[model samples]
Target: MGPAGEVLWDVALPASPSRLPGATMAGFADRGRTPAGLRLIPPPAVTLALVFGPGTVVLSGAAGRGSVVAGLGFGTTRVRQAADFSCVQVRLPPAVAGAVLGVRPAELGGAFVALDDLWGRDAARLAERLSETSSWDERFALTDAVLARRAEAGPAADPEVAWAWRRLVRTRGLVRVERLASEVGWSRKRLWSRFQAQIGLPPKRAARLVRFDHAVHRLVAGQEAAFVAADAGYADQSHLHRDVRAFTGITPATVAGEPFLTVDDVAWPSSR
Candidate 1:
């Protein structure tokens, strides 16, 4: 799933039978001997990474290392491992971040925090349990059960904000924020404030992030930049390039070759 001469990391998407609301997907990646580091570009959903690894998960410029809860990255986030690693990564829409993690999306805003900070003893217990598991399937089941239990103990998002977030996702980030406010029967100001508080990004920025995500997948699919720009509602190729570079710190051509984006079709099939 990588370019020529690139080490192919093994990635598996394990199905979550629980159908937990607001949870997008969960995956297992065991990058054995792949020296390549990872840059997690801006995506529409928050990310939770739990490591039961052969190596430590280190974030750029951070003093400590551990499993993390990352908000919708407003910009590029770098992750590196010194050696082979095994971990379960979960994608949670903003609506579920609070319920499943007991924190608002805004709390994680634009940064990655050690899961131990948020989950305390529970985080350590889960890591120990996951490390003891013999297979990925067993780890996934345990992880899903933990999320379900936490969700029940935490607060859910405001119904209106939740609805608006779903609409943005369903539309692939192409819908207008004003229109969304109207549809939700909230004034534009109210919608803007609440969305920022709960979802961690303003409605317009969220839309742009989601749109950028869509364009990234298209580029990875081998679509021409001009066509992807036009189809994704960008003003032109330059605008699309600007957004891609802003989110990923690289040009469209480079992003197209990124193993992370290229492998997403298999790792996140339905999302692609």
Candidate 2:
């Protein structure tokens, strides 16, 4: 949920009775004359979205329905929403995504796949079941069950790879990839390849994505670009500018005004 002039939108957590590990949930709806299109800036986690309603929800250039899984830093995306619609969006940790999705997150990077393709008829069943639900709480419970089942049955990430990923996230991506390899007792090449296979991106790019995510939020909070650059660990404002452009293709000021980033602000202003 984000940017444009005077467009209205809303964000909410799922109704109570929720339980999922390493997954953050948010529900979205249109209020008033929402914009025809919404941009999705890259984020640091994999995304799962369930969309239903009279209006169409387009992702990137493709119109989508049912459920979809998108990889982290999936580049610039646009969602066209209907006048009346409801979406339950979830962000999953990369390792959790690997287990639940049954594929390397790298396979989904820079792209999205319909859950139907991956889950087959089970995906269709999920869509139909969710559409029939009488309450949001029921819908969330069903979703949690499906993901929990997969996470339990699927293979886990290598412990070293998982630990290295945790370090990158904990450090806000400020940790050096070289140091990660050394600390994990693996050669740089081994770490890089394994990290990419398991996490959907090379260690360095994932770190950049995480760092950019933190820095961008500060920008949205009204901090100066220069200040965000320094505090967020960029070498300089120019470095920050380059990273911003690489991810969003817009300057810092333009990215800051984005309504997508502001939706969470409207729902949880304290998050900033």
Candidate 3:
């Protein structure tokens, strides 16, 4: 809680996003004395969390105060270390993730990869630069500039695949694959193949994840599970239960109290 007793997490956003055609960001800090367990919930996009500060952020059992990337999938990752780190996290939609990350999102295979693995020395240098930076605004600017440059220089998603992914996102994953394939003038097999190749997950899996993301947030907002299931397009409360467990390895009640989703509105904002 903040000084005023509001639901507060020391998180900030850019004054205005200069780039990020389909991305959102947040600046996060934790200062509890005890070690913190941050259960990262995967959204519908690729995530990059850049860490730089007095303490460490341990992901996938490796302690790195640098940066880590989380590709799209149903996996549970916890931060294991002192709870005194500041991080700038960015979530990029498939349309921009491939270009910004400079590789097919499929290459990540729903796992955690240190930024050094992909960007090498550049990642170290960026961490140092961010640590030296004094203001959150400057930090956001530096991160955004690098992403824009990378997007301009790197590979791009196929136009058809990009369109299909966007459709899934816009519809909250409620649209059918056949509808997308027909709209793109491609057979279902071809669309599935290309989307998996570029976006990192097959069409059905990606849609399920997207739908889960939408439903999870509603749960976090304090809605009853039965009501959320009906409203979120799940076939039944049991279906919602299965998805929540499959994605986070926890029940809906536990998910409702998670700090990751609790801080989402302030950190991520609902616009994008």
Candidate 2 per-residue lDDT, tens place, 138-202, comes to 77788888888888877688889988988998899999989999999999999999999999899
lDDT (CA) per prediction = 0.81, 0.78, 0.83
Candidate 2, position 257, lDDT: 80
Better of 1 and 2 by TM-score: 1
How many clashes in each candidate? 0, 7, 0
Worst 10 residues of 2 by lDDT: 263-272
Over 203-241, each residue of candidate 3 has an lDDT whose tens digit, in order, gives 998999999999999987878999989987899999999
Model 2 C-alpha lDDT versus the unseen true structure: 0.78
Candidate 1 local lDDT, residue 229: 99
Show pairs that collide, candidate 3: none
Task: Name the runs in model 1 displaced over 4 angstroms.
Answer: 5-7, 16-18
Task: Give the lDDT of residue 101 in candidate 3.
Answer: 82
Cα lDDT of candidate 3 equals 0.83
Candidate 3, residue 234: lDDT: 91
Instruction: TM-score each candidate.
Output: 0.94, 0.90, 0.94
